[model samples]
Target: MTSKTLSAFLLNQLNELKDRGLYNTIDPLEGPNGPVIRMKGREFVNLSSNNYLGLATDKRLVDAAVEATIRFGVGSGAVRTINGTLALHVELEEKLAAFKGTEAAVAFQSGFNCNMAAISAVMGEGDAILSDELNHASIIDGCRLTKAKVIRYRHSDMDDLRTKAKEARESGAFGKIMAITDGVFSMDGDVAKLPDIAEIAESYDLITYVDDAHGSGVLGGGAGTVKHFGLSDRIDFQIGTLSKAVGAVGGYVAGTREVVDWLKARSRPFLFSTALPPGTVAACIEAIGILQESKQLQDRLWENAAYLRRGLQALGFSTGHTATPITPCMIGDEEKTQRFSARLYEEGVYAKAIVFPTVPKGTGRVRNMPTAEHTTKMLDRALAAYGKAGWELGLIR
Candidate 1:
């Protein structure tokens, strides 16, 4: 039965969130999450999906998933360490390693799980982790899971990282030190300074980990941020997600063969959780192949992003230092940000507002993710809506 005390606490917290305009309402997508999406019987230009290459609805991925499902059934039936490691899983890992230019790779059910598994698997009680101040929530949680001292340095501040690394190393309080960061920060769309990080890691003998979830299939000719900056050989752990630009689902860690072997043997998720389904694995494999085959999709994706970013800037919207396609139209106030998003929705755009906890308070924004599938007409329409919404809310002149 439900406890009254617990229920009351939940109600109070929810009420507070709503009162502050911090409660997010989920919009059920009525169809495939593509360049345009349907919700509540209405279609809108989709500026909210992470489908950078538009491969989520591509025929090749769909066909691959269907064929694999028919051949292997719906599930893997057991954890990977048990009897669930299918041939498809092996093939996918090999493809991922080659794509990331690493000696080996290991797959997880999701990008979140990859961090949860990999961090705890390698680092333990006596170790310390030097993390970026603005790293993703998954990385933060993963660090928490391990019994390590987590030192947060300034975001992308190489000097701060160097200082912290030196202090951690000199203190002799930890057995090992790992410097982890997001290759491409999803919120602000800025790329991490991997070259500087690699240099620091080498000087301090720190293990380097880059969670390139938002970088794969978008940068480095689709190889990712590590490779984009020519540091693939320098970074120790190269993590990426298949759900974003790859247009499938799952996460992977590409590193030396020894590290991959260690993770396969020790990562908790691989040891305890059921393996990713064969269909999803097969789809991911196909997506990687698609990305490897050409740079056409990546080119189109960048072109669209550039067009949208230019339009927003021209419209007087402040797009924070975005080096990639994840464009955020900054709106400062939480309620005003939510209202701006609602206004956009009313005008046939589906850009979502990112509020507190996702970003720091007072930094709320409407993040626009323009994909390769978005045409000029669609983007122009979205810009028009942004202008109208901004004017209505007195956000711009």
Candidate 2:
């Protein structure tokens, strides 16, 4: 299946990655990705998934998915532009718009692809984008795809953003300038300084783009980060992921009706890729409906986060500058951090080690994701495991 030269190149690259400890060896779960998971016939408290609200395994979501599958079949057979757009897809978009308090919305197959679609559709070579330095990889790639001049500013630094915004506006080198940031930094768990970013964007006439993948179900009563800071009317392109808290597989952008229409007409993902399956679309709609109807799940998520964070900190682990539920316990060495994560697995927890280029070097960590489904006892058990791992590794005394 491969030529000799290409095969050699692949083998060499694989060796290089392994030599540098950059190769990732994946561990597949045996069954459902829930509050806990089983691997190699051993159970561990799961703290690595992005299922923040526990809706992924919720009964209502399961029923909705099954019912949609029975009614619509197992697949959506073509691209949205080529007769794949189901009534469920349209209804999901409407629900998404309502949930985000936007005039309209457009869905994509994945959150990563959604960014690629949205950014490239609106920006081009003559334009410029001001991006937060610590923004998600999807955001970075999306900006690059537009062939725009990307200007990086310090993470969550309003002053730096203001300066960069002013420079970009005054450069006269670009036809349009956009300021983009992640609403919640996934690694650090810190919220974006959105209010300040909004004000700066307004002053410089920069288009505002926020990828609120982590904030959709965790903040603003499950609306999003923009709404949390009362900037719903101010943000231009509001992007979110159905896969995260919606317990489904898709992504969306909520904006003005004109923007949504334009994206539908021009966005590559919507134009070329096959539409999300009917069942996923229907389940996504149901999940958003559940969120809009109640804040019970959101409250439980926060309670769990607080309990876990407090427990970890009290046990002498540093949770880096987090404002939300994403808890990253710092371990300075890359190899040691990997070992620490292994120790946690041995101690019966599934928190994963994050290293460069996920985060910068010397800032490697064992990131724990506490979900709403995690009971107090489950959290306590995870904490105990963390304590054991940290102590045995001399990470804590």
Candidate 3:
């Protein structure tokens, strides 16, 4: 029923991806994506999941989800603007705002959607945005959707951001200017120089927006990067994801009451997309409560990361400038990176190869996400796999 030329075109593109070693074949995980994942009747040390605090499989969180489901049924059944805003949703947003140290917060179905909704809602044509070159795909897409003039500054280079902010302000071509950056860059696991960034924003009067997708539950004692540097009151928009450390499904933009009020009134994704199910919203609230009550989970997570980082570094594998727990084992060649990840999987580690387009070409890596749930024995096994794989591939001496 499909046109042959169109089908051929799709097939050819896929073939090109395969030829260039860019095709990603997703492995089917047989069980929960936890510290150890089961696949095809075998277990592998899971170093790929974003469950940094191990809340994804925590029984308290699971129980909360189940109880909420039983009480509220499966779905919210309508967009947020139309009969979908539940009391639990409001509680989740309130807790999110409190956790992020903002006056108010608004939730979206996914973190990607949060960027799309928040960025475009606040910025539009005739506005100008200064964005970090390495900020995330969602950020790039959000800026593009705004129809705003987006100027890329060198990653974490305060000098470049300063220069761009001055130019953008002095040019007098824009109605408004904003500077956006990730609180934590996931690929290299580097924390943004937020204090410096805040100083620049204040001088130039540039609105600050930080997508703290990788920072929440991992940094600032689980508050986030802005709080980590004591700049919680400086940034205009503080964005985070519940799906990662929160171990639930949703994203939020926490800012002033005006910003949240405006988003609720005008943000397209929030207005059009159906609200997150009751279980996710309730579980997310419970996660925040968990984080607020204790930093024990966060402490355990860091201990695990430090242990693994030391082990990997001792094994002569370069884990790049990671201020957080997300570790990247740099493998320069794309093909070799792919092969390295595959060999590690075969040997019981399940880290995924992150190659070109995801990161710059030739800076491919097998990113490791160490969780609180991982035991020392599991990390040891993963290190042994890395050692054997690196030796076989002539990557490490």
**Candidate number achieving the greatest lDDT relative to the actual structure:** 1
TM-scores of the candidates in the order shown: 0.99, 0.98, 0.99
lDDT of 2: 0.93
Tens-place lDDT per residue, model 2, 1-397, is 6899999999999998777766788999999899999999999999999999988988888899899999998999999999999999999999999989999999999999989999999999999999999999999999989889999998888999999888888989999899999999999999999999989999999999999999989999999999999999999999999999888889999999999999999999999999999888888988999999999999999999999999999999999899999999998788888899888888899988898889999899988889999999999999999888889889898
Residue pairs with backbone overlap in model 2? none
Off by over 4 Å in 2: none
Q: Candidate 3: where is the Cα deviation over 4 Å?
A: none
| C-alpha local distance difference test of each model | 0.95, 0.93, 0.93
* Candidate 3 collision pairs: none
**Residue 141 miss distance in model 1 (angstroms):** 0.4
Alpha-carbon RMSD to native, per candidate: 0.6, 1.0, 0.8
Question: Which residue window of length 10 is worst by lDDT in model 1?
Answer: 242-251
Model 1 lDDT per residue over 344-386, tens place? 9999999999999899999999999999999999999999999
